[model samples]
Target: MPTPSEFFDPSFIAILKLFLAMLLGGIIGTERAVFARQAAGTRTFGLVAMGACLFIVTGNYVDVAYLGVLSFDPLRVAAAIIMGIGFLGGGLIIFRGDSLHGVTTAAGLWIVAGIGMAVGFGLYLIAIFATFLTLLMFTGMWFVEDRFKHWFEEVKGDSR
Candidate 1:
């Protein structure tokens, strides 16, 4: 059977990828906002993901279109993106007296950026799976950490 016309159109595929990246980022960001109460929320994350997707998709297009005029390395852009996100994440983190805050939020931003790149590179399944894993870590691990802390306190009390 012949494939649908939309499947062959690069524009359509790019739009779809951008949309999916935004959706995935929004999901992760919502969890962070509502549960973790992080500063970066749904709209911020959605914009980040879509921005990464656009960068990668545009880089790929340029590389393909100008195959001989100049050399274009998509990895270069990806690396820059990682570095840029690191700066943004660093800004989100704050060190106070004997405590640090926004570390998880910073890390989540970095990972969500990677997820956006994956969507841009046509790895939909991997991106989706990673999104779910991120949510599981953010939500499920909180409960686990609390229980472990409680158990440790109980054991310490008994020993004393």
Candidate 2:
């Protein structure tokens, strides 16, 4: 008659988890949006993360009985994620003779998936912390790389 199982029920908690995935992904994505200068920005990353999380959560349901009986292999969802991630990462990588583009975006998407996965499993704390760390690493890497480049140039000049 009514809801059979809380897991089966479309509860606010489930929706909230999905929302959290988007927000956490966006938090890290903001940097990618403006700075990485990729076609896929804040909206893209946010949407991908939330969409993946929903896919995982819904995959866990999916009325599996249609095939034979209702059963889910969370690992299947994880495997799908990994396969899709490889494609996304490849999308971000472009060879331009001697330089590359979209590597940052690729890495960002990769990290965002972990955040999304954490949210899917209802690990809110991990999701939050991961979001923060992702941002820190994303922002920090540029400065560190730039400084290292300058140092290398200076050392070369001294050697000359």
Candidate 3:
């Protein structure tokens, strides 16, 4: 039998994964948190990602401990997490008369959950790439959107 330290050392991978999830979530949330329109902030995003990772890690632990004798599915836990995150995302959206706001924030919540899952599954590269792309979308796309809005308004004014 191995010592306690040796037995517990293997679990460090899960901790690393969860930390990555938290870091990615914090990056995304930082961008949103700076804006006044966002409903979810850094802490919320961090928690969501970390929470998702925790569930996946826990399910995996149970599955491994039981081996083939018991059927503990990590995918089921993932599915449930997705569903719950969806509900939470819905809460971020606000529908107004002519426009809908908070859609981006809601989408962020959903994608952050996905990032967490990827990390939990040991897909570090995938999670990092997704985080980079998400940040680009959130930041770069804002400028593009603003420019297009300005151009559209100018065109509309000239037409009138």
Best by TM-score: 1
lDDT of 3 by residue, 1-160 (tens): 7644366664887888789999999889988998644769898998898888888888888898899899787889999999999999989888899899888998999999999988888777998899999889999988999999999999999999
Ranking of all candidate structures by their TM-score, best first? 1, 3, 2
Query: Which 10 residues in a row give candidate 3 its minimum summed lDDT?
Result: 1-10
What lDDT score belongs to each candidate, Candidate 1 first? 0.90, 0.79, 0.88
Candidate with the larger lDDT of 1 and 3: 1
TM-score of each: 0.93, 0.84, 0.88
After superposition, candidate 1 runs with Cα above 4 Å error:
1-6
Sorted on lDDT, highest at the top, how do the candidates line up? 1, 3, 2
For each of the candidates, the C-alpha root-mean-square deviation to the true structure, in angstroms, is: 1.7, 4.1, 3.7
Tell me the tens digit of each residue's lDDT in model 1 across 52-104: 88899999999989999998899999999999999998999999999999999
**lDDT tens per residue, model 2, 1-160:** 6543455655566687789899887877778877766687788788778977887777765644345565667768867886787798888799999998888788888878878877877777988888888887878877899999999999999998
What TM-score does structure 1 among the candidates reach?
Answer: 0.93
* lDDT of residue 66 for candidate 2: 47
